[model samples]
Structures are given as C-alpha cells and as structure tokens.
Target: MLVLTRKTNEAITIGEDIEITILSIHGDQVKIGINAPKKIDIHRKEVFIAIKEENHEAVKTVSLDSLKNFIRKS
Candidate 1:
C-alpha cells in the first residue's frame, strides 16, 4: 500500500484522469474529495464490497435452467 500524508487543499493525481484531494481535517477524521470522469465509477470500500457480494450471491442463485424456463414463458 502507498501511504501518503496530505494537508487540506492538497491533492494527488492518479494516471491522467483522477484527482484525490484533502478537503478537511478534524482530529482523526479527514474528509476527501475525488475528481474523475463520468464514465468511471467511484465507490467507498464498504459499498464496493457489498456490491461485489451481492453480485456473487446473484450469480450463485441464477441457473441456466431457470433462465431457460423464464425465456420459454416469455
């Protein structure tokens, strides 16, 4: 992991498109802002993990037979 220390208003650019900036600092809590293209997705770690887990569960519950039946009904 690349650890960095940034004061408020400081920013770091990723590749050529994304910019991460420090917005505010209060004791241990720090607020940050991200700038990226609209086509790119930016999600918090927990939210991203939850989304991945949901996708995994969905795949597990879905089967070819079920899809075929549904398609036949349609």
Candidate 2:
C-alpha cells in the first residue's frame, strides 16, 4: 500500500492518465477528486468488494444442468 500526504489542490498522477487531487479536509474526513478517461472504472473499496462478491455468487449459482432443464422446458 502506498501512503501519501497531500494538501489542498495537490495532485498525484497514476500512469500517464489518471490524477487524484486533494480537494478539502474537514475534521477527519478528506475529500478528493479523481480525473481519468471515461473508459476507466473507479469505485469505492467497499462497493468494489460488494460487486466482486455478487459476481462470484452469481457464477457459483449457475449450473449447466439447470440451464439445460430450463431450455428443455422452454
């Protein structure tokens, strides 16, 4: 994990494209802005983890035999 300290308006660049900038600091919460191409995906850590878990569950619940039965019924 990379830990960096940045003041307001200071930015850290990733690769040649993405930029993360410190916007404001209020109490213990710090606000940051991210700049990247539209093709890039950005998500909060918790949200990303939730999405990954949902995808894993979906894959686990899928069965070829069940799919075949459904197709036959249709």
Candidate 3:
C-alpha cells in the first residue's frame, strides 16, 4: 500500500481527474473530501463489499432458476 502523510487542506491527485483532500481532523477522526468526475464511482469499503456480495447472490439465483427451467423442459 502506498502511504503518505497529509495535513489539513492538503490534497493528492490521481491520474488527471481525481483529487482527495483532507478537510479536517478531530482527534482520531479525519474528514476528507474528494473531487472527481461524475463518471467515477466512490464507495466506502464496507458498502462496496456488500454490493459485490449482493451481485454474486443475484447471479446465483439467476443460474439456479435457469437450471430449474431447463430441467422442467427436458
């Protein structure tokens, strides 16, 4: 992992479009702001993981339904 230290109001840029900045720091909690094009997606790690798992479950349900339909037709 690439780690860097940034103080309040400091920012780091990614590629040509994304920029992440430190907005504030209160004890252990840090607030950040991100600037990016609307086409880009940004999600918290937990939220992203939940979405991935939901998609996987949906695919499994679809496959099971397909198999059942195939068996019924046979």
Q: Write model 2 residue lDDT over 1-74, tens digit each, in one string.
A: 99998999999999999999999999999999999999999999999999999999998998999989999999
Model 1, span 1-74: residue lDDT tens? 88998899999999999999999999999999999999999999999999999999999999999999999999
Alpha-carbon RMSD of each model: 2.1, 3.1, 4.3
lDDT by residue (tens digit), candidate 3, 1-74: 88999999999999999999999999999999999999888999999999999999888778777889999999
What's each prediction's TM-score? 0.86, 0.83, 0.83
- Candidate 3: Cα lDDT at 59: 80
Ranking by lDDT: 2, 1, 3
Candidate 2 regions off by >4 Å? 66-74
Top candidate on TM-score is 1
Q: Which candidate leads in lDDT?
A: 2
Q: What's the distance in Å from true for residue 63, model 1? A: 1.2
Clashes of 2: 0
Model 1: runs farther than 4 Å from truth? 68-74
Query: What are the Cα lDDT values of the candidates?
Result: 0.96, 0.97, 0.95
